[model samples]
Target: MLKWILRRTTGKCELERICSSYPAGAERTRAVEYSLSKSKLAALKILLVSDGLNASDAANNIITLKGVDITRNEGFRPALLQCLRHISGYQKLVSEVTRLQKEKYSTAIDDHEQQLLKLWSLLKPARSRKTSKTKRVGELGFQGNDPATDFRGMGLLGLQNLVFFAENYNRSARKVLSESFHPKFGYSFAVVGINLTSLILELLCKEQLKSHFYNSVSGEPSLYHFHRVYCHVFCEFHDFWFAEEPESVMEFSRILELYKVHLLSRLTTPGMRLHSEFLAD
Candidate 1:
C-alpha cells in the first residue's frame, strides 16, 4: 500500500509524517487526532479516549510500535508527546467542567456559601449590611433575593466562574458590573454571568472551542484554563451587548444568538485564540 511505501521510503510513520508536515495548533493537532483514531493498535485507540495519560510513556510506546528511530527522528517523541497531552488534557477539562456544572449549589456547603459571599463583597464593597438580600442581590442583577436560584441551571459552575473573574480580574469585573448599571443599556450582572456559563458549556460540549484551546495552550488544558475562557467570553459579551445598543434587556436572547454566531465564525479560523482586551488593563 502507499502507506507502507511512504513508511519504508520516508522512514517515518503516518503520525510522524503528519507532525512534521503541519505546524502545531489546530492543523497539527487535528491531523494527529485523526491519525491516532484510525490507528490499528489498541493502545493508540485507547489514548484517544483516556484521560490523565502519561504523555512521555505514551510517546515512547508510539515510537516503539511505529518503529521510529530516535536518532533520525529525534523531534518525533517530543512532538507526539505534546499532541498527546493536548488531546487528553481537553478531555480532562471537559470532565471537570461537567462535574462542576452538575454540582448543585447548597446553602449547607460552606465553600458554596463562602464563594457567594465573596462575590457580594467583591462587587458591592461599599454597600451597607442593612440592605436586604433581595434588594441587594437585585442590584447586582439576580432575578430574586436568593442568587442561589439563578445558579440552578449552571450549578456551581456559574458561581465559580463569576468568582474567578471577580477574584482574578477584579478591575475588569467591577468595570463590567458598573456598565451593567447603565440606565438605558443596563442588564443584570450575575444573571448575565450565568447565561455566559451556559454559552461556554455549549461551546465546550460541541467541541467548538478546540481551535482556541489548541492555539492558546501548549500543554494539557485545566479547569483554570476553562475559567480563563469563561472570563474572555463574559468580557466579550459585555462589549458586544453594549455595542449593539438593543432596545432593552428583552432583546438579550436575540443579541446573544448574534454573538454566538459571530463567535462560531471566528472559531472556524485556523488559529483562533479568545482573549479579552480588558485583561491588559
Candidate 2:
C-alpha cells in the first residue's frame, strides 16, 4: 500500500517494482561471471607489466588499490588460467543442470491435466458470482475467501498437489476452460482479475524484498508467494479481495504499523517526474 502510493505521488513507473510483500531469494546467477571478469582484468594487468607493458589506465586504477604486479608475478598466471577454466566449466554445468531441470518441470506439468481439473473443481462459487460456462467473470473476479478447505491449507504444499495434476496450464487448459468447462462449472468457477495480476506481477518485479514475514517452521513457501497465488486464482470473483479494499495513498503510519516507500530513494533527477508525466497519458 505504501509503495503503491509513493510511486503515484513521486510519479515513477515503479508500479512493477514495489508491491513485493514476500521473499524471492538471491537471483544472482551472474555473480561468478562478474567475479571472473574482475579477476581476469587484474591478471591481465600483471601479465602486461611482466612483458614490460604498462597497465591500461582503467586497469591501473583498480591495481592501484590491490598493490599487486600481476604481470611480474609469473606464478599467478597458472592460478588465474585455472580459475578462468573452472568458471567456464561451472558455467557449462549450470547451463546443463538448468536445462535438465526445466525439462523435468515441463514433463511433470505436461502429464497432469486431469489432476488440475480435479483440484480446480474445488473452487466452489459464491452467491454473487455469475454462473457461466467460463472460469472467468465477465468483469468482476473471484469473490470467495472462505477458501475451499477441502484440500490442505493454502500453501506451496497445496499448489504442489495442484501442480502435480497441472498438465500445462500454459495452453489448452486456459483455452478449454475459456471455451467449455466454464459452461459446465461457471456456476462453480472462479478466476483472477486484473488488479491482482498487476499486483502479483509487480511483486515479481521488485529488485529486493524483506521476506522474514514468509518464514515458517515448516518451510512451506514464502508468505508473499502464497498470498500472491491466492490472489492470482481468486482475484476474478465478484468483490475479489483486492477490490474489497482498493489501494489508497498513505502519508503516515498507524501506531502499530511500519510501512515505507521510497520513490526518490535512488533518483538522480527528481524532475524526471514531470518529464514522465509530460510523455505519459
lDDT of 2 by residue, 161-243 (tens): 23322232323223323432333223222232222222332332241211211221112223334333433233232222223
lDDT of 1 by residue, 1-281 (tens): 89999988988889999889988888888889888888888988898788778888888888888888889877877888888888889888888889999999876687887788788888788874433345567877788877778889999999999999998898889999988999899999999999999999999878888888888999998889889998998889999999999899999999999999999999989778987776735
Winning candidate number (TM-score):
1
Lowest lDDT sum, 10 consecutive residues, model 1, at: 127-136
Q: How high is the CA lDDT of each candidate model?
A: 0.87, 0.29
Give lDDT: candidate 2, residue 20: 28
> How well does candidate 2 score on lDDT at residue 199?
32
How high is the lDDT of residue 144 in model 1? 86
Per-model root-mean-square deviation over C-alphas: 1.7, 19.2
lDDT for 77 (candidate 1): 79
